[model samples]
Target: MNKALPMSGVRDSTYIPENILSVPPNLSMEAAMKETEEVIFGAIVSVLAKTKVECSEIGILIVNCTLFDPIPSLTSNEGIV
Candidate 1:
């Protein structure tokens, strides 16, 4: 028997500093990228554990982040899934 599982999450205001509310929109792109990666990875891991999907069973992984691109690759996500 086979099953399909879908998981998703959202993390708003990733680059917004904790102390500054009225600051300009010049948030750190690097921080936002890292935060996005972390959130996605966490969500995928949670889904896998809850669904009991083996790592080898995963065939595809996709991430959507257009605001921050120059940070780095999401290779770390492989470890999470």
Candidate 2:
């Protein structure tokens, strides 16, 4: 399934978390959380950089993830925004 991603039109530049690329995958909660943080923060940083928007000036933000429900809700993360 991992090797089929590029053939399925996923661009070469797209970020695939390390665990997902593993032979059997490491789907443990810890790995999921790391993947979540990497994707979310990476995207936030990219958009902020491109738009020149200050994080503090933003009024609303939303994040949706269906893979797993984390112990501390993602919205409750202190340093994200």
Candidate 3:
């Protein structure tokens, strides 16, 4: 959270996992997936709203995530472009 660090200009309101802030941080796959979904969905909604683009207008979507690739994938799970 140090502003002096590179790429540390993240907003104060950014969503951070509770476990990450805990005294002894624990890794939670569930928490990570939830955060990922929130971030990706939020970005999609924001872009669509800003561009005034309809969901149906989107022909293809390429989601690239290295860490947590689900079996159904986000696109398949949501059924949304």
Overall lDDT per candidate, in order of appearance: 0.58, 0.80, 0.71
Off by over 4 Å in 3: 1-19, 66-81
Which digits, one per residue and each the tens of the lDDT, describe model 3 over residues 3-73? 56438755668656675777776567676667677677889899999999999999887887765566777
Per-residue lDDT of 1-81 in model 1, one digit per residue for the tens? 123222233245345443234355445755555566677777888999999999899888777655445435555544333
Assess the local accuracy of residue 63 in candidate 2 as a C-alpha lDDT between 0 and 100.
Answer: 87
Q: What shift in Å separates residue 44 of candidate 2 from its native position after superposition? A: 0.4
Per-residue CA lDDT of model 2 for 1-81, tens digit only, reads 788986888887875779978989898877887788888888899999999999999988888888657658777755443
What TM-score quantifies how close candidate 1 is to the native fold?
Answer: 0.48
Error at 40, model 2, angstroms: 0.5
Give the CA lDDT, 0 to 100, for residue 48 in model 3: 98
TM-score to true structure, per model: 0.48, 0.65, 0.58
58 Cα displacement, candidate 2 (Å): 0.9
Top-TM-score structure, candidate number? 2
